[model samples]
Target chain A: MAYSIPTRQSTADIIFAQLRKEIMSLDLLPGTKLSEAEVAAKFGVSRQPVREALNLLSSESLVEIQPQKATRVGRFSMRRIEAARFARRAIEIEVLKNASENWSDVYAPSFARCLDAQRRAVAEQDTHSFQTLDEEFHALMADVAKAPFAFQQIKSHKSYIDRICALSLKDAAEMAVLVRDHEALLTHLAAQDATGAEAALRIHLSRIEKTIAAVHHANAEYFND
Target chain B: MAYSIPTRQSTADIIFAQLRKEIMSLDLLPGTKLSEAEVAAKFGVSRQPVREALNLLSSESLVEIQPQKATRVGRFSMRRIEAARFARRAIEIEVLKNASENWSDVYAPSFARCLDAQRRAVAEQDTHSFQTLDEEFHALMADVAKAPFAFQQIKSHKSYIDRICALSLKDAAEMAVLVRDHEALLTHLAAQDATGAEAALRIHLSRIEKTIAAVHHANAEYFND
Candidate 1:
């Protein structure tokens, strides 16, 4: 289901959203300490809102809050990272299968358009835009399959993967590979080859597995076994 | 990943967990209004903690919050229910496949024990226990497959489905059917029949689809299109 439009967000929500983005983008790197008073001052809000925001983030494992101890950005747990990958792969493969079965001329243009945007994003070295487009490309498959809700699980699990990917984004060559994989996946989908589409998707996702070690080594302090 | 053991919980966390259980169990039916002040009074705490709890629940879509308006238990959106079902089925089927392939003598007894618990729960007419056992049975499969993380997605999605199931617990006969399904699934797993296990799991999940129309009709006010 889609997020309900908030007519007016509470101060806590505003802070939570901002902090969540920062944490996910690694702007607030893992192991960074967060204090309610300091964060509240930075946001020009009271500590109450900041506390609430941290509490929410803690629930999602984005931050670790210890009783009577300083709160810190959560360490990257490999267990969680692996779990996220497994969940995303399972859900996306099913979504691709459905999209393949439902392939139609009507779905072709949108898929083509997303790939075009991906190429532009890569050429322009716009990692942020490319990341957004990457998500949209997969999400579009769910939409085309008439099961847009499948993207919720995909997005949820992707948060963990995205953080790791953010650390690996320096490899621009990977962007080209991702786009190529997407194109191959789309080709299979257009051909109504469910099995081929799943194979292509598996290859696309496996890139993350291959890069995990390098990313972890580069950001050693951020990870936990 | 497993939840970190909390050394101590704040007042807010305690209240939040309790309220979350109540909401998911359908004790707080859809459309029931919740007030920060009233909840605080009931819990003998300040309004701050209650407000925080509501915010957390809102994030989970367990409650609907509006500025300057009453927060209410979230309506059962058919779309969300369908999505949760789709996600859980996909993940569980995959987990069953793995469990079948990895079937060891050690895994058999646990499945058999869980099924025994299910039978006892049904015979005793303990719907709550039956529900818990039902979850455990599926979660056990993921554990057996060494894909324990899959249970996280399954449990997340099951929250939405459980609320719907709570309303249909009156049909004691359905519990028996669920146990039978589990028995057949365990038989397939014991035989190391991945395909058979997946087929049995599909049949088990499909029961929910068959009940949706009847449950929605019976609890008309709790659902939304």
Candidate 2:
């Protein structure tokens, strides 16, 4: 989905969303200080809302708050990253298995639509759009399986993975590989082959392992050991 | 784990924790109005922190905030409860499978200790302690599997299940069944039987479906359809 600016959120909600996006997209890099006073001034709000926003972010582990010290964008936590990967893999595999069992002709069109959008994104070299479509593809799987909540967990755990993917997307070949993985997964699902679909998904998700290593080597300073 | 009152928390943090406990324990019953002025006065803090705390709770779906309307303890959301259940079941089953594979002699003592504590809680008729121990049992499984993050997801999705469980715990027989389920699960784990452990865990988690029904029947007002 395209990131539409929220129009009707509370001041604190707006600040939280903006800061969360910046942090997840790595615009506010790890270890970057977030001054409450400066953020308040920049958002044209008081420190109360700014502090509230920071507290919200801290809860998500996107920002670290130290008592009597400055708040900073959280360093990439390898443990949390691994946890996210594990949770995503487990949930998506389960979802794919369910989708494979319940596969119908109606689901094929949705998969094709997402793949078509993804192919366009690849040709345009729009990594941002590709990333959004990538999420949509997985979300469609969960939707087909009637397990929308699985997508919520995946989305929650995906921030870390997405940030790493953001860095890895500079390699155009990576996007092509992702599109191919989606095709393979769709083929398996179309055949109602749960085992094959799961295998395809395992390979699809494993791409992140290599991406994590590549991203970490290039941006070691952003990570926590 | 013992619910240690946080000693080194900010004003907002303290309020959030206090309100969260009250809400989760059903001390602050669903639909109870939470006025900012009243809460601030009750806590002897300013409204700023109170608003922040409410915002925090809102994020967790423990409180509901509507623009230009008073905030209140959220009505128990069945959809959210089901979502939590689905996520918890998927993650825990995966954790159990992993724990079964990595089962070692060293892991038996931890499960036994938790079971021992659970037995004590049941005998003493301390449902609260039983609840805590129940969480410890599952967390220990995740810990043994070397997937601590899985426990985090479980914990995060558990608050809804937990609140429902707290309501259901008035039935003494229910607690006995839970302890028995733990014993059964532990037996499978000790035997390193992954499939058997998964089956045990599934049955263990399925207890909540009945509890949800019973709790809703007894306390219909607390729930939303």
Candidate 3:
């Protein structure tokens, strides 16, 4: 008979998402040991689901599972991080090109809303809220392009990047720079200048890449060390 | 204390890779339950490492984990498979464009080598071998553009498409059509015509998409039914 979608996801999926969000938000630190029994007890589920959830996280590279040893929250690898950032930049360039060619008025309000949320987050100086808003803004751009799946890939890649960015979350001034870039991109989108919009997006994406790298270098001890 | 820069990852990562290869190759059928203790016993490791490997598979969406229930080989989704095909086509068009602009003689041999491999695979009637070579051919194109990461995304998408393709492996004549398309793409890539190359790549991707969709419709029972 007909029923709700069943969340068809196992308890492991639920546990995995909860832990992943914690890891992504830095509620769980990198190098933190994720004991299966402990997690199982905490969630009041069997160690099996916790084990399954941890397995999923390991595949995402968000956790490290060592043989005969403990599984830990994943540490940052500068090289892998750089590679992901580069891929994101490359793919977004092509996406921006598509957006430029097919600019739409439908996405403007979404952009405005994300921008407004960003403004509110920054004005409040709440790092957590600002970062969340930042993700929404980038997602809005992808949605504006009418390719939500592409944005999903972008979000996954961004999630990898996000774990690291969270390490340097105290940079409020830099948030302003990102806000400016987003505004410029929104402007280009509004003007329907495909060429202009692409140029702005490239610059905007580059700023993010550069800032991320710089922060990583500045605090080398916080990463793969 | 140096040990070849740890070229070998942890056992969990290694097992995850091996299992992923098997699943992608369809040696592991959809809906097959993977027992942690059994797999661990087979790998001569503890359940801890095996659990981690399964987690990795789950993250890739290659395995399905049920909390306190069972972790099975991932089932195919027609919608996810379609999305992956579309994404691959979208990105490859841009990658082909990049290759055309920066066409080089250095990668010609590499390209031809993959093409020859595909030819050999076709002659031998080995669909599995042919698929690997097909992936290599697309990879070579991305290398020509000096953007190897582009192929990484393509492969990720290809995995989703391949799960569906596994069931539709009966049509030798249709396979022949796909081979011809690959040959045409190679011809255009060799000529360094950005416009022509992209057009060919788009045609190649679209054909596969159409074929795959047709197969999916005809065999809906094999999918997420």
Which numbered prediction scores highest in lDDT against the true structure? 1
lDDT of 2 by residue, B85-197 (tens): 88788788789888988889987788888899999898998987887898899899999888987888889888778777677646567889989999999889989898799
Better of 1 and 3 by DockQ: 1
Candidate 3 residue-wise lDDT, B1-225, digit = tens:
656665558787778888888898788888888999888888898988778788767767888988678999988776576557656776687678778777877777887777777667777778878877778878877887767878887888777777666666645566677678877776777687776776777677776666577766886655684
Off by over 4 Å in 1: A1-6, A123-125, B1-6
True contacts kept of 2: 0.72
True contacts kept of 3: 0.41
TM-score, predicted candidate 3 vs. hidden true structure: 0.77
Task: Give the alpha carbon lDDT tens digit for every residue of A104-220 in model 2.
Answer: 999888889999999998898998888889989999999888888889888988876787666655556778998999999999998999889988988998877877888889999
Using lDDT as the yardstick, the better of models 1 and 2 is 1
Docking class of 2: medium
- Identify the superior model by lDDT, candidate 2 or candidate 3: 2
How close to the true structure is residue B131 of candidate 3, measured as C-alpha lDDT?
A: 78
CA lDDT of each candidate?
0.87, 0.86, 0.75
Using TM-score, give the best candidate's number. 1
- lDDT score for residue B45 of model 1: 96
Task: List TM-scores for all candidates, in order.
Answer: 0.92, 0.91, 0.77
Instruction: State which docking tier applies to candidate 3.
Output: acceptable
What TM-score does chain A of model 3 get? 0.83
